[model samples]
Target: MRSTGMRARSVPHDSRPVHARPRETEYRPRHPLDLARVVLPQRHGAGDPTMAAANGVIWRASRTPDGPATLALRAGAGGHVRAAAWGPGAEWALDQLPALCGADDDPTGFDAGAHPLVAEAHRRHPDLRIGRTDLVFDALVSAIIEQKVTGMQAFGAWRRIVAWYGERAPGPTPKPMFAPPTIEGWRRVPSWAWHRAGLEPPQSRTIVEAARRGDAIVRAAASAPDADGRERIFTSLRGVGVWTSAETRIRAFGDPDAVSVGDYHLAHHVGFVLTGSRVDDDGMLELLAPWAGQRQRVIRLLYASGIQEPRRGPRMHPEDHRDR
Candidate 1:
């Protein structure tokens, strides 16, 4: 059993005046079912090895198939989750943790086993777990929100929707957790409402279209082979494409093989990392040639290994379509 405590505080940033409640809980993932051991150390941040820091709103408190297990994140001071949940859909969440952590990844497809880079990554992180949030609705909604917006903008919109429409998870979770939007809730969003959501007409249309056929999409994506299958299905729609589908599959099904195609920055990142300079679609394909079937795994391993290209160009400014 977990414990709770409350304390009030004042904040200058939040305009909505409300009482603050600081909750704390002692989580003991049943022995022999040790979660800390299953917990993949955070490989993408700058921090103490023992603690996982926030990577934005993607981190939130969640429950798993097992009793009250925390998904892909670390608990914060006030008991907030630094990551999102991977609900119980499959054993892949934990069973495939090793591969996700670069432990069992085979990047020979990415090279002739001649490249020492991917091999080194696996050596560094042996227990990394890929998040498995099986809730299709949540993944789809987030994907729609992220269609054409910046990460910050998309996350902000997600926070608003969750705060307004989602429910708190039943447990000792610190931050507010919400269930995915229902079909009815999605249909009720007015055109004006989407404007306030910081979304454009194209993205909004895609979301509505998907929502209307949401059930079909979920079933198809779930039953498909992997990221590639999911992409094939998602792109069949008028609006969904390679990037959106890849993003969805990575978290929705925890498919280790879903690589985002046509990303504004991914090809460049891949190029710099592998060939010491930026690359285009062709170069990226060449670099990832060995890992064609498991390209996504290589990407995940690279991301987890903490190697990055140096920043030089200007950043993508967030477009607040709400103001247009």
Candidate 2:
């Protein structure tokens, strides 16, 4: 029911407090429109909060009107926000609403005509949309946090950073919203803090070094011709290998072809999914040879197929360097 009533609400994503914003007040499209649908591949480590089924397509939050800390986003044409959900940092979330919907995927390079996997996946699940994420900031932080550590270790570190430095989400739901640490914040993290985050010296040093030169790296990426070029420039830094660079690119530019070649888990997952056998990096590459330019897309499809890795051992435990 579309309402022309006055109401107030907070916004989502941003950590700041909420204010007021004028919205459609009802769930009516500005124009008659149908739902926009697209197919997506299931894969490990490709989670985006916007795509999370629990959040739904229409996100509502309250804050200010112009760059409000909170906002409501409806999926489809003439996307009209309904009501205000209030909070802080709503503007940041709203600012990224379009990117959250995966608006930047270049159809020319990734269309089904060239990549059969994408075509097949689309055929299988017509509602999946392949959207490109804005990776510029998150990629750098994730890459730094992930340097030379187990997944559990890295995730723990990332959580700590967010909890300490991030703000509350401005949505109706009180979610822990985070602002990716600024370049200044990155430089200020002490050595002891890294140790407490369960990061070893190598990973810590790499991040610090990267942080010191972060501006240059960002500039390089901004000026590059494509994601591949950005990866190449990022890799030129010390301690950044093929795996690290590729992993970062996956988030930053949403490079569809950026297959994580050197990851500890990816090759094994690919092997198990594709060949029903565990394989090394070389084996994984060989198996994916058929997909060539769309290697990442193939990996995404295999993952979306809902295949799981057969476990033969115990999981890694979380270690807190803070205790030491």
Judging by lDDT against the true structure, name the best candidate: 2
Please give the range of 10 consecutive residues that has the lowest summed lDDT in model 1.
6-15
| List of clashing residue pairs for candidate 1 | 59-82, 59-83, 60-83, 86-132, 101-128, 109-290, 109-291, 110-290, 110-291
Regions of model 2 farther than 4 Å from truth: 1-95, 107-122, 127-130, 168-173, 316-324
lDDT of 2 by residue, 1-324 (tens): 843252211113344555455323333332322223321221112232222222444332211223224344445335543334344444445454443344444434544433444457645653332433344545666666675567666777765554444434345443433334555556667676667667777767777788788777777886899867887887787777777777777665666678776676788898887667899889988977766766776676666667787678887653322111
RMSD of each: 10.0, 10.0
lDDT at position 186, candidate 2: 63
State the C-alpha lDDT per candidate: 0.53, 0.54
For residue 157, model 2's alpha carbon misses the true position, in angstroms, by 0.6
- Give the per-residue Cα lDDT of candidate 1 at 107: 36
> Which ten residues in a row are the worst by lDDT in model 2?
38-47
**Clash tally, candidates in order:** 9, 37
